[model samples]
Target: MDNEKVRLQLYMARCGVASRRKCEEIISQGRVSVNGSVVIQPGTKVDDDDRVTMDGRLIKPTRKNIYIALHKPSKFLCSNEDPDGRSLAIDLISPVIKQRLFNVGRLDYLTSGLIFFTNDGDFAKKMTHPSSHVEKEYVVTTKKEIPEELMENFKKGIYVGGEFFKMKSYKLNGTNSVNIVLEEGKNRELRKVFQSQNINVKKVHRIRIGNVKLTGINSGHFRHLSEREIKSLLRDSSSKNGKYNNKGNRHNIK
Candidate 1:
């Protein structure tokens, strides 16, 4: 017998409700129910036959998957709604992608760049998990020229809000801009790091996520990721404990 039951939060994440960790939070708050019974346990297993619901709405298993690479523009929140009437990233996605989809991670409201969205929760979990260590490359322009010492500080790590944050790699791109690769995705982390050095970031843009790049995709436009691109992302995320893959590809924008 091939009996396999995945964790409930993992299942919910696959449905594009939220990240697995956030799904766990939703479950603990009694927002998730299985077969009409509220389930607060994050590790509860459900097989293919089981029915799941969130917030009293039944969750339908999806066979058709949607993966979009969005060139997110500044001022768009990566959320479903905003009380201030600001636009959300979802507003830019094609209406054809009506299947529940959520941003894999986050980009600040003032940052412009490539962001991935998908209906596959397992893929989301694998990409965003700290253990996966998928590198995110960015092109940042600061108010002042980045000093060589500050570049070293980025490599050595800096203390921000009592937490130590570090960049995996940093390089001087131009007089006022720098290219940085970060393995950890903390909230407004890059901005905070630059601020700690008394430098103001004038612009921040994510150039690459995993093996996918934002090349040719204009701001506010989105397109489905190619099959090869999707497979490459999975391969890179799977190599978390091994050497970084996809190093020499010309499409690596940042």
Candidate 2:
């Protein structure tokens, strides 16, 4: 129907460009055009007949949404393109999947862990949003003896380089190893916190995200998420600790 118009950001997200929020950023930067005119407003309406182009290439909504969990190896980038020719994490799954997909959140280049790639923008936004309180578990190994105050300070909230960092939970596995859970999963978070105390981190491996576990997957391997698993993840975002909360804001998909 010609009357079935949708927001530009939502339209772009449906096309597998990125999350709706990211599409808004891209739109604001005037990277999207509607019917041959640049449209910077994210709220601009468009229908099936309207021509939409991103970076001068026409794009349409993806018919299928794919969600996959990947066991990303260390030293691989979580980006679509890198000017320096560094290895991209997406390349590992691209040849097999053959679809336009983007990472849900991010893992630093040198950090190895479980990461998700999908064309569902709403899922990406929900997983990454702060209020969702999705827990990510990582196992960290340090070169030196673990600091006694490290866990306490991080749990209580520590400031490094003027940025506040905190852990949802922490458990010491051994003298030099510990398991940490983070709700925010800030960029290079563990490294920065450890570096603040002059502690050298040997390895940082992410093992879990929400209800999803990386137990059976080997490094560089990927698997499609089961329908139940996808529903569980979405459920996790809406509830915490067996209680439902309405504190999180959500974007509507037209």
Candidate 3:
């Protein structure tokens, strides 16, 4: 395995620590060591014989990959560390799942919905990559009636701080709510669109990601993704199909 040396960030990700990007952050913080020496460079490479640790804790690549679907509730942070001591969404699964896992993407502190956690770094990269084109569906509720021009402008696309934001599709749920789908879930994309139109958003909850749905799951709870479900997500990431069928068996946390 001498020729198998890889970058530090990629190694951490393969060990189920976190995504490569998050691993890079950890490395920059001087939390990782190679051969007993703290290595802050994310590009540092290592071979099979090298010893690697994080915060003095030995880390090795996990043999079995795990995938999970979590129904996050509002007010929970989707991060490994929070300065304000707020509730963490990952805390809900850590007690039951022994392996080290991290979130694939983030949900706003006040926005709740279906979130994914996994130990497979490659899978995380596949699902969150810009070219994935994976659809994320959300139900947005507003305090006042949604004007026709607001949805029209959103579907047609608009510029927010020089960043263009648009929705893949939308359907009005009521006078003040609508169901929307987005392929590229930019940071606060929905909120920015509504705010641009002077609309006060009351809630934004994700109901689906790719082929997975949040149905039958309660807030702050999680379930293991079936092999087929995992395969479907990876498959859909490369396909152009906008409709994701969710018929996977749900294994709820007892």
Q: lDDT values of the candidates?
A: 0.83, 0.89, 0.87
TM match of model 1 to true structure? 0.88
Candidate 2 local distance difference test against the native: 0.89
Query: Model 3: per-residue lDDT, tens digit, 119-204?
Result: 98888987887666788999999998988777877788778878888787899987999999888778888898888878889999
Predicted candidate 1 versus true structure: per-residue lDDT over 1-254, tens digit per residue = 03368898877776678778888999999988898899999999986678798988888556677899999999999987899999899889847677788888899999999999888877888888766678899999988988889778868877778877778897788889998988766898888888988999999999999788899999999989999998988887787634434443222111
Better of 1 and 3 by TM-score: 3
Q: What is candidate 3's local distance difference test score?
A: 0.87
Off by over 4 Å in 1: 1-4, 242-254
After TM-score superposition, the amount by which residue 49's alpha carbon in candidate 3 deviates from its true location, in angstroms, is 2.1
The worst-scoring run of ten residues by lDDT in candidate 1 lies at: 245-254
Better of 1 and 2 by lDDT: 2
Scanning candidate 2 in windows of ten residues, the lowest lDDT window is 245-254
Sorting all predicted structures by lDDT, with the top scorer first, yields 2, 3, 1
Q: How well does model 1 score by local distance difference test?
A: 0.83
- What's the C-alpha lDDT at position 232 in model 2? 99
Better of 2 and 3 by lDDT: 2
Residue 34 deviation, candidate 1, in Å?
Answer: 1.9
Quick one: best lDDT, which candidate?
Answer: 2
Query: Number of backbone collisions per candidate, in order?
Result: 2, 0, 0
Candidate 3 TM-score versus the reference: 0.89
